[model samples]
Target: MVEYPHPVDIKVHQKSRFLDIAFDDGSHFSLPCEYLRVYSPSAETRGHSPATAKLERGKEMVSITQIEPVGQYAIKIHFDDGHNSGLYDWRYLYNLGKHHDELWQAYLDKLKAVGYQRKDPELAPPDVDV
Candidate 1:
């Protein structure tokens, strides 16, 4: 069985809309609020299955308003857009951090394909990997 990574620290920089997560494995990631919001694990985004997952749009200016911890396994992030149902676990966060570049590019590509213009360029910077 695979073991999930544990986070050592989680800091939310509301001003910059950055969520910095430091894992016990010594991996640190600076995740933009937009990225996290778009990829939220909530049913609202993921739906009932992988095939039913929906692409989020027009969230370039979204910011994390609050982060509520859920037990010892995950956190429920509250967005300024009033989306507060997603639960982000340690493993998911680590994976998101590890694949930040590819995931971000994919998000951008999808946005372009769907003609969804992003308002904030800071959402997906060229040098986002950690």
Candidate 2:
């Protein structure tokens, strides 16, 4: 059996909206909060399978409100947007980090294909639109 690497440290930088995770294999990933929110492994985001996956948009300003450990294998991340589902396991998180560039490019391509213009978080209005 393949031994998946385990995280040695994890830090949430709320100001920068990035989650930095360091694994035992000397690999590290700095994942953006927006990316994590959009790629959440929950039924609401991932659905039942890849064929039913949902594309999330407008999460550029999302931040990590909290991160709760699930046993020794996973962590549940809470976003400022009120989404708290999805348990990110070691293997899954590692894969996400390993393929960040490719996956991110694919996501960008999909958004472009649908003509979804991502708003600049610095210039965009708050989540609550009046």
Query: Estimated TM-score per prediction?
Result: 0.89, 0.90
Worst 10 residues of 1 by lDDT: 121-130
lDDT of 2 by residue, 80-102 (tens): 99999999999989999999999
Which pairs of residues have clashing backbones in candidate 2?
none
RMSD of each: 3.5, 5.3
In model 2, which range of ten residues has the least summed lDDT? 121-130
Cα distance off (Å), candidate 2, residue 129: 27
Against the reference, the lDDT scores of all candidates come to 0.87, 0.88
Where does candidate 1 stray beyond 4 Å? 122-130
Q: Candidate 1, residues 23-67: lDDT per residue as tens digits? A: 998888989888999999899898899899899998887888889
In TM-score terms, candidate 2 sits at 0.90
